[model samples]
Target: MSDPALVTIPARRGKAARVKQGQIVKVINTHGDQVVDTWAFNADDLNEFMSMEHTRPHIMKIMPAVGDAMLTNKRRPILTFIEDTSGGVHDTIISACDRYRYKFLGVEGYHDNCTDNLQAAMGELGLAAPETPCPLNLFMNIPVHADGSLSFEPPVSTAGSYVALRAEMDLVIAFSACPQDILPINGVGHLPTEAHFSVD
Candidate 1:
């Protein structure tokens, strides 16, 4: 094992974990219907990070599949989607939530958001966000409408449903237990909860 399963990512928070090449990382929604915004970077070079802009066209499928490789900005493989238990529903188009989003949504006061979550995790790794990038929204339900617009729906993953990815290169994986209650990304209460991560 390159790294053992780390601790539960607290509700409305995030963390960064290391997974070496050939190691597997699994993200689990223990409470069910929770969305985890995940980002990855090359451990040796943070600038060569995962890029949805490149991965989207390369795959040509909005919804990726098992064996599909999520690519980096330079079009290199980052992680291979080896297993998906929630019928492969995920998002590559949406960016992580930030404070501006809440303010735009008329949410009063300060809020814990995904952008900050990722930043915190990155800071821990002595890294920085050179640019804002869209993440792989695991278990998120954003359907492409007939008109090419998008619609949000509740996730179908039950408790214990998980997605597994094997690192293609040494990587620093970061994640946030999304904190978008108003968007209904987490279903009814919009209340966030703990999630699990294990490296094997």
Candidate 2:
């Protein structure tokens, strides 16, 4: 069969789709710098979503590598990393940026953030995320230092590089082309860009 059509996760926005067990979801770094905050939820139960804290100990790594299974809050495998051509750099510690984060950064008004983007994306599918668990920050580069500190750095992924994850269970996958222009997480240019994904 032909390849599935690409779905666009618009710049500074979010998108989500459903995938069946054993299917693969390929997320593309379309512009090279955009950080896609990704999450997976059990289609039969939204309460059990992918949990970074749970996954870290389960996989024994801060971030997943090829063959690592991302676990849910209940500690069940949800998605498995099958391929990665984006330098294998991702983040699992940082919480999704929210309106409160912008406020803390001194923004007087509203700011688009990953937390909101996630809900909006799911809302489009007539669903609601019970909670915003820490996401698998795709292509996000945050360096942990020897001093036990962390720094938000630009993504190392080049344009069109992608990661392929296979669904371990029938689930809904959500992604936010993170709208974090105030930090260098996306890039030193502080510009958010669009991303793409395909389920097969």
Candidate 3:
């Protein structure tokens, strides 16, 4: 259970939320089937945001374990993976949901998606949305097999499982409660999830 002081919200599809610096945000899979793709940026300087290309090598080589610190593109500590209750926080290898991805998934006509949520969030914050980049797929199960293949499978997290991150700086966190219906990441259907924020 999270601390009572934490603010919790049910993140619906195509919506976004922001977290302040030094705050701890916990994304909880309230139900068994939801995918949350996350991105972080320096609130003061939007240019210093999470970069998939820069982070890929670290994620692949150092594979973040519980309590590992995730560094920003500027080589600054961004967040500490404090708690992984379900032991399954994925990497940037899995592509972030977007209009093109939806097209490939045969859901091109769907109006809701993770990219929309991210753009919406940026818009709300008066930040311009740039070319889409790969995002960290929180709660998504993308296993790297010994043969160097990736498999998108049902999440290892069950209902009530969560991953907690303590912000190392003033981070503008953006996320989409992914509405990816064509993959097992969403259990074949899109679902809502809960996000909790704690300021210590």
Candidate 4:
């Protein structure tokens, strides 16, 4: 029982912690073409965060698989995907990269986004984020077309691969190693590395 301390999430930067009810974060795409950008809140109610549009209608599906629980936006639940070796191809509809989405992806200055690395990782735990919610993009791949449209594709998760969640209550789990070098999600050589997490 020793090995549960990997916290990093660096590269473009952002990290956060404090999880309790059931604990078990995991998240480590270590080098698997990084694309973290997860989020959660509640920790007593920071406006009750976590909500990918209320978890895609309470997990009807847009990716989430291993058990699927994720709710919150007042819908409830919190987090509970349970585990995945990556390759579950996540991305419940994109919407994180900020700074006006790198100035409409043309980037002329200041990039490093993920909505400012989730408000500087919840202001280094001093706490803050009461807004930027719509994450859970872990290992993002974005591909959905057939007319509906959506395509940023890249990561299928490789290098180390991981994904696990469980804190369906006392939350506060932000992360964001996604600097997004101008699409390709985070690969195709767009480069934006660094990711890790543990919790247990």
Candidate 5:
């Protein structure tokens, strides 16, 4: 049996872990109204990583439903959504936040971002942070207009809500407990919080 594990991903930070093929990884929004940026890498080949680009077209969806498969850049199933309890509001089009993003927006000085969280998570796995991929923004609310424009809005998730995925391949998963405070992604500059991740 796969040893069960749970890691508390502190708000505004991130975490990484490995899961065997067929194991489940549950991303819990311990506190509602936060976004969890997520990515996955094939344990045998980092280059063949999860791609929201491939996932969207492959599944023909921006918001995945229960039973949807998260495909890799190579068009392979890496994870499958087995269950969701947040009305399936996950976003597939937004890229993870990076330091330059804040700087460009005139936020002076070094600011922690999803990129930093991703790096921290990667370090735990002893892997280099490869070119960042667009992530599956769990519980994030990116409102799209009729004119095809996008705007950030408060998330729709509630505390204790969660999404569960089953690994299709041996996987290395990375998560960024998003630290976006701008646009109040997590309420007034991303007040960090702890989230639960468990394998069963």
Candidate 6:
């Protein structure tokens, strides 16, 4: 087992996480208040991208648990959940942070949105530039209300809790260490989070 420690990477504007065919990368929520909206695509084909619409239904309304497999739009396995200590891995509800959302949420000043990071990731991988969409918000706490409404809440994960995933394909994983100030994930402060990758 790898040691549990906080590793901080400088936030590059448009760089993605490029992992080889059989490598494992872990994104840790070192600080209790942070959210990371992530997406994955085939390293060779841009069309083969992660789809929340396809994934949400397959998960069968239950939030992702430890050891659950994440599927892509083509029904290809992307990543398998290896650790989920928070017990609040919300895969369906929270959308990726973008510029339009920033304006709508009264946070227009923050141009360095999640989409930028995703685009950067793609560029780094030498993949075709594609329009970004709603991404999977990891470590984010979005609770479902009794009336079926969703409310963003403080992170359920503590300072040291983390979620791990094993890549099932040669994937280009793009993530935005979400700079969301309007939401609670960053404690309403839009603080940056830490990330680390290692071969298992």
Considering every candidate listed, which one attains the maximal lDDT?
2
TM-score: the better of candidates 5 and 6: 5
**Deviation from native of the Cα of residue 69 in model 1, angstroms:** 0.4
Off by over 4 Å in 2: 1-4
Per-residue lDDT of model 2, residues 1-200, tens digit only: 13458999999999999999999999999888889999999999999999999999998889789999999989999999999999999999999999999999999899999999999999999999999999999999998899989998999999889999999999999999999998898889768988999998
**Per-residue lDDT of model 1, residues 55-151, tens digit only:** 9899998878898999999999999999988767899988888989999999999999999999888888788867657899998889999999998
User: Which stretches of model 5 miss by more than 4 angstroms?
Assistant: 1-4, 188-190
- What's the TM-score of each model vs. the native? 0.94, 0.97, 0.83, 0.32, 0.94, 0.84
Model 2 worst lDDT run, 10 consecutive residues:
1-10
Candidate 2: what lDDT?
0.94
Candidate with the larger TM-score of 3 and 5:
5
Q: Please provide, for model 5 over 72-186, each residue's C-alpha lDDT reduced to its tens digit, 9 standing for 90 to 100.
A: 9999999999999976788998898988998887899988889888888999879866778899999888878899998887778888899999999998999988877766766
Q: Global CA lDDT of candidate 4, please?
A: 0.85
Better of 1 and 5 by TM-score: 1
Candidate with better lDDT, 5 vs 6: 5
Give the CA lDDT, 0 to 100, for residue 95 in model 2.
95
Every candidate's lDDT = 0.87, 0.94, 0.68, 0.85, 0.86, 0.68
In TM-score terms, which candidate is top? Answer: 2
- CA-only RMSD, every prediction: 2.4, 1.8, 2.9, 15.9, 2.7, 3.1
- Name the runs in model 4 displaced over 4 angstroms: 1-9, 12-14, 17-36, 45-49, 53-73, 76-90, 93-134, 138-141, 147-173, 178-184, 194-200
Q: For each predicted model, how many residue pairs clash, with residues at least 3 apart or on different chains?
A: 1, 0, 1, 1, 3, 5
* Predicted candidate 3 versus true structure: per-residue lDDT over 1-200, tens digit per residue: 55676554346443334556667777776675667777888777767776666754665542455666676677677777788876665666766677887787676465567777778767867776564557777778777799988887777777877788888778677777776656667665445555444445
